[model samples]
Target: GGGWCSSDETCTYRLTNGLGSSKYYNETVFFGEIKSTNKTVNPDFYNWNRIVVEYCDSSSFMGKANHPKIISRGAQIFYAVMEELLEKGMASAKN
Candidate 1:
Protein backbone atom coordinates (compact mmCIF):
# COMPACT_ATOMS: atom_id res chain seq x y z
CA GLY A 1 0.00 0.00 0.00
CA GLY A 2 0.96 3.67 -0.48
CA GLY A 3 0.05 6.89 1.25
CA TRP A 4 -0.22 10.50 0.13
CA CYS A 5 -1.12 13.82 1.65
CA SER A 6 -2.46 17.10 0.31
CA SER A 7 -3.15 20.48 1.89
CA ASP A 8 -6.69 19.27 2.49
CA GLU A 9 -6.46 15.61 3.35
CA THR A 10 -4.40 12.45 3.61
CA CYS A 11 -5.21 9.30 1.68
CA THR A 12 -4.11 5.70 1.57
CA TYR A 13 -3.62 3.83 -1.68
CA ARG A 14 -3.29 0.27 -2.89
CA LEU A 15 -2.57 -1.18 -6.30
CA THR A 16 -5.18 -2.94 -8.37
CA ASN A 17 -4.35 -5.27 -11.23
CA GLY A 18 -6.23 -5.54 -14.52
CA LEU A 19 -5.80 -6.71 -18.07
CA GLY A 20 -5.34 -5.10 -21.52
CA SER A 21 -4.34 -1.61 -22.47
CA SER A 22 -6.98 1.11 -22.06
CA LYS A 23 -4.94 3.58 -24.10
CA TYR A 24 -4.66 1.21 -27.02
CA TYR A 25 -8.35 0.41 -26.69
CA ASN A 26 -9.41 4.05 -26.91
CA GLU A 27 -6.91 4.89 -29.63
CA THR A 28 -8.02 1.97 -31.71
CA VAL A 29 -11.58 3.19 -31.52
CA PHE A 30 -10.69 6.73 -32.49
CA PHE A 31 -8.40 5.67 -35.32
CA GLY A 32 -10.96 3.16 -36.44
CA GLU A 33 -13.50 5.95 -36.84
CA ILE A 34 -10.98 8.00 -38.79
CA LYS A 35 -9.95 5.11 -41.02
CA SER A 36 -13.58 4.21 -41.64
CA THR A 37 -14.00 7.58 -43.34
CA ASN A 38 -11.04 6.77 -45.62
CA LYS A 39 -8.98 9.56 -44.01
CA THR A 40 -11.51 12.14 -45.27
CA VAL A 41 -12.49 12.99 -41.71
CA ASN A 42 -13.00 16.32 -40.03
CA PRO A 43 -10.31 17.83 -37.84
CA ASP A 44 -12.90 18.54 -35.19
CA PHE A 45 -13.02 14.86 -34.37
CA TYR A 46 -9.28 14.79 -33.94
CA ASN A 47 -9.46 17.54 -31.37
CA TRP A 48 -12.12 15.66 -29.50
CA ASN A 49 -10.85 13.49 -26.65
CA ARG A 50 -11.74 9.93 -25.79
CA ILE A 51 -11.57 7.60 -22.80
CA VAL A 52 -11.63 3.90 -22.14
CA VAL A 53 -13.30 2.67 -18.98
CA GLU A 54 -12.19 -0.45 -17.17
CA TYR A 55 -15.17 -2.34 -15.87
CA CYS A 56 -15.34 -5.37 -13.56
CA ASP A 57 -12.45 -7.79 -13.86
CA SER A 58 -10.55 -7.28 -17.12
CA SER A 59 -13.47 -5.89 -19.07
CA SER A 60 -13.42 -2.44 -20.64
CA PHE A 61 -15.82 0.08 -22.18
CA MET A 62 -15.70 3.37 -24.08
CA GLY A 63 -17.74 6.40 -23.12
CA LYS A 64 -18.55 9.57 -25.06
CA ALA A 65 -15.69 11.81 -26.14
CA ASN A 66 -15.02 15.16 -24.38
CA HIS A 67 -17.50 14.20 -21.69
CA PRO A 68 -16.74 14.13 -18.01
CA LYS A 69 -15.87 10.80 -16.35
CA ILE A 70 -15.58 8.94 -19.62
CA ILE A 71 -12.84 6.78 -18.17
CA SER A 72 -12.60 5.02 -14.85
CA ARG A 73 -9.44 3.16 -13.84
CA GLY A 74 -9.85 2.47 -10.14
CA ALA A 75 -6.08 2.03 -10.07
CA GLN A 76 -6.42 -0.94 -12.33
CA ILE A 77 -6.55 -0.06 -16.01
CA PHE A 78 -3.01 -0.03 -17.39
CA TYR A 79 -3.27 2.84 -19.92
CA ALA A 80 -4.53 6.39 -19.67
CA VAL A 81 -6.05 8.21 -22.62
CA MET A 82 -4.81 11.62 -21.52
CA GLU A 83 -1.24 10.36 -21.52
CA GLU A 84 -1.75 8.87 -24.94
CA LEU A 85 -3.23 12.09 -26.29
CA LEU A 86 -0.25 14.06 -25.10
CA GLU A 87 2.23 11.56 -26.50
CA LYS A 88 0.43 11.34 -29.85
CA GLY A 89 0.27 15.14 -30.21
CA MET A 90 -3.47 14.90 -30.39
CA ALA A 91 -3.88 17.36 -27.52
CA SER A 92 -2.23 20.71 -27.13
CA ALA A 93 -0.30 22.05 -24.14
CA LYS A 94 -3.14 24.43 -23.35
CA ASN A 95 -5.43 21.47 -22.99
Candidate 2:
Protein backbone atom coordinates (compact mmCIF):
# COMPACT_ATOMS: atom_id res chain seq x y z
CA GLY A 1 0.00 0.00 0.00
CA GLY A 2 2.78 2.44 0.80
CA GLY A 3 6.35 1.25 0.23
CA TRP A 4 7.24 -1.26 -2.42
CA CYS A 5 8.48 -4.14 -0.25
CA SER A 6 7.89 -4.99 3.35
CA SER A 7 10.73 -5.08 5.86
CA ASP A 8 10.01 -8.68 6.66
CA GLU A 9 13.43 -9.60 5.24
CA THR A 10 16.98 -8.32 5.31
CA CYS A 11 19.65 -8.15 2.65
CA THR A 12 23.42 -8.55 2.90
CA TYR A 13 25.72 -5.98 1.31
CA ARG A 14 29.46 -5.39 1.31
CA LEU A 15 30.67 -1.88 0.57
CA THR A 16 33.85 0.18 0.30
CA ASN A 17 34.34 3.89 0.95
CA GLY A 18 37.33 5.07 -1.09
CA LEU A 19 36.41 8.74 -0.78
CA GLY A 20 39.09 9.18 1.84
CA SER A 21 38.69 12.87 2.67
CA SER A 22 40.40 14.19 -0.47
CA LYS A 23 39.62 17.70 0.68
CA TYR A 24 42.48 19.17 -1.36
CA TYR A 25 40.29 18.94 -4.47
CA ASN A 26 37.02 17.32 -3.37
CA GLU A 27 37.23 13.76 -4.57
CA THR A 28 35.28 10.61 -3.61
CA VAL A 29 35.16 6.94 -4.58
CA PHE A 30 33.00 4.04 -3.46
CA PHE A 31 31.82 0.58 -4.48
CA GLY A 32 29.51 -2.07 -3.05
CA GLU A 33 28.60 -5.74 -3.26
CA ILE A 34 24.98 -6.50 -2.35
CA LYS A 35 23.13 -9.77 -2.06
CA SER A 36 19.63 -10.64 -1.02
CA THR A 37 18.47 -13.71 0.93
CA ASN A 38 15.14 -14.01 -0.81
CA LYS A 39 16.33 -16.77 -3.06
CA THR A 40 12.77 -17.49 -4.12
CA VAL A 41 12.85 -14.32 -6.20
CA ASN A 42 15.39 -13.05 -8.70
CA PRO A 43 17.72 -10.07 -8.31
CA ASP A 44 16.07 -8.11 -11.12
CA PHE A 45 13.05 -7.53 -8.88
CA TYR A 46 15.03 -5.02 -6.82
CA ASN A 47 15.63 -2.69 -9.73
CA TRP A 48 13.18 -0.04 -8.50
CA ASN A 49 14.76 0.16 -5.07
CA ARG A 50 18.24 1.56 -4.56
CA ILE A 51 20.89 1.94 -1.90
CA VAL A 52 21.55 5.67 -1.41
CA VAL A 53 24.99 6.55 -0.10
CA GLU A 54 25.19 10.02 1.39
CA TYR A 55 28.14 12.25 2.25
CA CYS A 56 28.30 15.24 4.58
CA ASP A 57 30.89 17.88 5.25
CA SER A 58 30.74 20.84 7.63
CA SER A 59 32.93 22.98 9.88
CA SER A 60 35.38 23.45 7.04
CA PHE A 61 36.67 26.43 5.15
CA MET A 62 33.69 26.20 2.84
CA GLY A 63 31.30 24.48 5.26
CA LYS A 64 32.05 26.79 8.15
CA ALA A 65 29.01 27.58 10.27
CA ASN A 66 26.77 26.01 7.66
CA HIS A 67 24.81 22.79 7.37
CA PRO A 68 26.79 19.90 5.98
CA LYS A 69 26.47 19.53 2.22
CA ILE A 70 24.82 16.24 1.29
CA ILE A 71 25.34 14.17 -1.82
CA SER A 72 23.74 10.85 -2.80
CA ARG A 73 25.30 8.11 -4.89
CA GLY A 74 23.27 5.23 -6.34
CA ALA A 75 24.12 1.58 -6.89
CA GLN A 76 25.64 0.36 -10.16
CA ILE A 77 26.37 -3.33 -9.84
CA PHE A 78 22.88 -4.14 -8.65
CA TYR A 79 21.33 -3.39 -12.00
CA ALA A 80 23.93 -5.32 -13.91
CA VAL A 81 23.28 -8.27 -11.63
CA MET A 82 19.60 -7.81 -12.19
CA GLU A 83 20.03 -7.72 -15.95
CA GLU A 84 21.78 -11.04 -15.77
CA LEU A 85 19.03 -12.52 -13.65
CA LEU A 86 16.36 -11.32 -16.07
CA GLU A 87 18.10 -13.05 -18.93
CA LYS A 88 17.10 -16.31 -17.25
CA GLY A 89 13.51 -15.04 -17.06
CA MET A 90 13.46 -15.73 -13.34
CA ALA A 91 13.39 -12.05 -12.43
CA SER A 92 10.42 -9.72 -12.30
CA ALA A 93 10.26 -5.94 -12.02
CA LYS A 94 9.21 -4.54 -8.70
CA ASN A 95 7.69 -1.15 -7.94
Highest TM-score model number: 1
Q: What is candidate 2's local distance difference test score?
A: 0.31
**Predicted structure 2, TM vs. truth:** 0.20
The per-residue C-alpha lDDT of model 2 at residue 6 equals 15
lDDT tens string, model 2, 1-95? 01121121210011122121223333443323343334344454433444332232211112222113332222333454556677756466543
**N/CA/C clash count, model 2:** 0
lDDT of each: 0.35, 0.31
Residue 67 lDDT in candidate 1:
15
Ten-residue stretch with the least lDDT total in model 2: 6-15
Residue 30 in candidate 1 has what lDDT?
A: 39
